[model samples]
Target: MKRAITGLLNRLRFKQKLFLSYLVVIIIPILVLGVYAYNQSKEMLRIQGIQGIVKNVDTISGSIDGSVERYNHAVQSIVLNKTFQKIVTNDYSDLVNLSYDLQEYLTPYFNMMVMLDQEIDDVKFYTQTYVPEYGDSVQSADRVKDEDWYQSALKGKGSQWFSDNGLIVVAAFPRFFSDKATNLVYMRINEASMFKNVAALAKDGTVAITNDRGDVIYSNQGATGERLEAGQLQGMKEGAIRIGGIESYLVKKTVKQTGWTIYFIVPAKELSRNAGSIINATLIVIAGCIVIVLIMIWMFSKTMIRRIYALNSVMKRVEIGDLSIRIRSESKDEIGELTNRFGSMLARLNDLIDELFRNKIVQKEAEFKALQWQMNPHFLYNTLSFINWKALRSDDADISRVVTTLSKFYRTGLNRGNNMIPVRDELEHVKSYIEIIQTMKDHSFDVEYDIDEAVFGHTTINFILQPLAENAIMHGIARKESGRGLLRISAKLSNGKVVFQVQDNGIGMPLETANTLLQNDSSGYGMKNVNERLRLKYSSDYSFTVESAVDRGTQMSIVIPAYLQS
Candidate 1:
């Protein structure tokens, strides 16, 4: 199965490969990321929503507890008042004056509390010091002593809460105000006014207030069958609550002083409902983004595939030596760079081909020259040999000896068909050429050799020495008059290499001109040919150098690696 799949992929073109690659590169990651982001965002927003709703519930709980606490302080304020305490005392016999004073004290206090908060329904003291007036809200001691608020206050020993009734603060005063009867101060608050903001913050939620005994005293959804049970809300400070086949988020807070638990009941799915639209909108945007991304990938990959196809076509043409083909692109992408480099390679390839053809033509000319070279020198040597033998017969010894040396020179110079020859043979060849030149120039130049005999067993490139000798004679020695011209040829072994130098005393050129020896060799067929041949055979490490000083002798040198027989 893997092999079949691999074969299928191998048959796909670059266009198909690029398109599929872009889909995998773009679509898969975006889809995965989109899914991950959607889930994470939904969870994060859900937590924030639950937190915000719970925070609002806690705020409402705080407000209710704070109002009741403020009432405790208000009630204590009138209780500690000296004049009102004295006026409301039972021992005061002037009934009209005492009652009038009592009315005066309590009326102003009542009006003040009523104006301060709507929760303040009324504030009253049921003290034993006072009797109830006609149509007054204050209760006499006999009618209210057994009341729940009064009983609770007595048990509490100070301020006490009967949330079903109100706050009852029943106290025993000293003999100065109430030695005979108990003094009681109570403040009744409106339940609806106290929990009004809870309704506002809850919106769609039910607000339930439960006492420490797990008894529900107040709920916004009064008498609803689906309301949270007291047992479910107990000890459940915060979390999801399930009851009666319904799920809800239960946010409960306790009023520490009153032992009252305030609950905000909300549907558990409310968080999801709030966040559903956002995740949906995100999914839609991501879907649109993916569509656009796929389109962009298709377009970009198509352009890439088209450019690659063009490059492939050019390569096919290049395979058959058609180097004129190329791809043109204005983009600064990798493909464009590849096409540019490929074009450069083709251009270089064409240049090398032209260079190779030119070098081959030069080689054929050199070979033709080698053939002519063999014929001309051999014919001259043979003619000279005949003349020398004839001259010897006639007893002309000097002429015969010179011609005999010339014969030997041409014979050894050819060196059978070998490019490499003995160093001694090269030296002898140079000697013969110099001897002939000396005779021709009327011995104007003198010849000197400092060759080591050890070098005779080693070999040198053939036909190398004769050209240097010719250059020394013609360019340096022959230019001078009389015995002033001198030619010296030397060869020695140095540091595992051979150094051959030809020095001449004549009209010497400047150092600047001597430094450009190889460059100037291009102007001469012999020097240029020898320089190219040496460079081709032995590389740039085997080279020539020319050194000269004005009015001094010039030296031309060749240095090459020495080869010893294994």
Candidate 2:
């Protein structure tokens, strides 16, 4: 699988491959962490919710215990009162005196005590001896004594709880009227009113209070029928469980004094709903971040790939011998540096090729010069013998002067094994050639130099001028009859380049014939050799312009790079 993916990647462009790799490297981690974090966060929030609910249950349980404590203390206050004990244990013969004493002392205290607690519904005292009925509260003693609560209050010791289909809490204590018997004090508070705050706090779910006997006492939802079984409440203190038919997360806190457990119940799905939303939101933001990152990676990779594609395209052209290709490398990264290096390498390769070609041309020129030198001696021997004979027979110094000019021409033309010579030497050699031609032709052609004086010391190819001058005299001036033909040569510098021209005022041919003469063939070696030699020595950027017209003039101009060897 890995190899197949790699092969497919190799077939794609560099930018696509880089974008894929970066996405995998970056996005995979983001996705993996996003999922992992989402799940972990959801679970953490669930636990945290359970903890918060447990605290809520504890707060409610504490409030219930506080209310019960206050009720019990109020009863204890009444039991410890000496005045109430003396009144209950009093031997008042008349009920009227006792009624007056109870009303004057206890009625105002009961009204004041009821005013202190909002949940306090009634505060009553049951006594077997005195004020059992109408003296303190009811009008008949039988009505009070006949009640079960009055009888139970005498038997019961501490706080007692009884409900008349509604939740109720009673604070009962003994009033020690005498050693043999004791009266009871009862302080009752409405349990429904006491648990109202706890019920309000349970807006999301149900809150219930159950006694130690597995009987539910009070519920926030007013559900007192169903209670947690002892088996269900056995081991689990806090967890999710089914109560009756409802599945809920249950938090249980047991009040030590009352042995009543406060139960906070929320639906299992409700506990996770808020936490799930938070986790989902986090995942969405992470996905968005991943998308933005992928876009940036693709953009960066595309820019780099564009540069590489350009380099590769230019290299393809270079492969076909077009070495003029160049890349605009302005970046500073490693890839940009690589592009710059490739450009440098191509330039170096082009230079090496040009150098090799120049070396080949130089070798060929040397061979041509060697062959020409070998063919020169026969002409020299015959010419010297003829010159000597002419001088001996005619007794004329012109023949000696012609022989001397020919000798100087050949000597300077050879130039002691150097292809490059000063402009002065070339002009002198051409002057010797013109002198020979003037003698041979009865002085019919005239040659003049309008050359720059500074151009004399400058370097040029040896014998270049002499050959052009010879071509002028032979091809142009010799064709004209009875005309004093003129050949002009000039040289100068222009725009950092060296330029010189050869002109002849004679029977000049047409432009087509002038161009045909410069082409190298079996009969056209001189112009071709000069053109090739100049191109090899300098660059191929030099120019050779030919201008000619019938019976007017012909001009052969050559431009080469300026190089002064000091």
Candidate 3:
């Protein structure tokens, strides 16, 4: 299966392969992580929402506790006042004195207490003494003696809290009052000021303050008049719960001072509402990233595939034997490098083809020229022998010698239509040519032969040394100024190779002229032809060099591998 998959992938183009790689290496992993992150974010937001609401409920509970504490302090102050106690317990004989004491001390004290706390709407004293009914401030104890809250306050040691008609009342019995009378001071607390914190929370969700009797004393949900059943809110301190058939989160705190519980109820959907937005935003970001990555992948694949396609086109052209195409790229990537290397290979291939054809043409030309010369070698040799016999019979020694030497030169040069010859035969051929040149130039130049015996065993290309000797005598020896030109011809074995040198102390040419002698074809079968012939025979192993200085001398050397005669 794995091999089948690999084969399938390998058949795809570069762009397709790149896209597939991106899908597996980049896109798929991103999508997986995005999904995981979205789920984690949703859970985190839900948990954080619950935590936030719990903190708000705790803050509101503390604020309500503080308000209730202040109100309690106010009630305690009134109960512990000695003057208020004396006034409530005094037996008055005149209504004028009773009214004077009530207006002078008790009214000012009550007004001061109310002024200090804005939540206190009113302060009233209920007594069974002969105190006149001083409006609501000094109410008769008989007015509320039978009232459950009043009775409770009289029997209770401390103050008792009561909720009545949208008001929070604190009823407390005065200290040291007459036992015959049930005197109490009750303070009216503004419900709005007392439950302001709970009201603030109501704007967001349902909030309620329930008393110990399971009666909701203050409900922002308009359920203040409703009563809860026993254990209705049990085990609902801080977690999700079902309220009125709707799933909601419940956070509850008890105010120790009032024995009332504050309940902050928020629907589960509402808490998760923000989580939805966060998840949506996260998904959008992930989608945007994926889109950008896809674009980049596409661009990268396009770039790479375009270069490959170009290379493919060039290769197709080459397949049809067209090797002249040129491709160029400026990129530093591996694809560009491959393209450059391919171009180099094509160039090298073209060079080898050209060199092979050139070598073949040179070999064919050499054979044709040899065949042209072979056609009349026997006839020319017979004619030259007849001329030598005639000169010998007439006593013309120079003519006989020239004719004899000419016959010898042609005899050795032809060598029975074979291109290979011994070193001794080639040297004899060159000696005959030199004899003819001396006869023509009147022996103007001196000649020397420094041949090594070791080189006699090796063979070289025929007719190569004759041209060098001719060039030396014509271009070097013939151009000498005053002194007789000295021509030196030497052959030796050096470093497993055969070396032939032709040198002359004649008027030498410039360095540039000497260098171009082997390159310029117009120089004619002298150095350039010999160099090409040596290369055809030995490739790059042979070396030919010309060294000369103006008016000094010229030296030409030919080096080839030492091939022994078989």
Give the number of the best model, judged by TM-score: 3
Q: Clashes in each model (backbone N, CA, C under 3 Å)?
A: 0, 1, 0
The Cα RMSD of model 1 versus the native structure comes to 24.0
**Each prediction's whole-model lDDT (CA):** 0.72, 0.73, 0.80
| lDDT score for candidate 3 against the true structure | 0.80
Minimal lDDT window, size 10, model 3: 221-230
Tens-digit lDDT string for candidate 3 (471-505) = 88888889888988899989999999999999999
Please provide, for model 1 over 94-174, each residue's C-alpha lDDT reduced to its tens digit, 9 standing for 90 to 100: 678667766686677677778977677776656665565423435566667776656666555545556555323344333
- TM-score of every prediction relative to native: 0.42, 0.41, 0.43
**247-295 per-residue lDDT for model 2 (tens digits):** 7787878887667877777876667654566777787888788889788
Candidate 2 segments exceeding 4 Å error: 1-33, 90-93, 130-132, 135-156, 167-182, 222-238, 244-246, 272-284, 287-566
Position 310, candidate 2: lDDT: 79
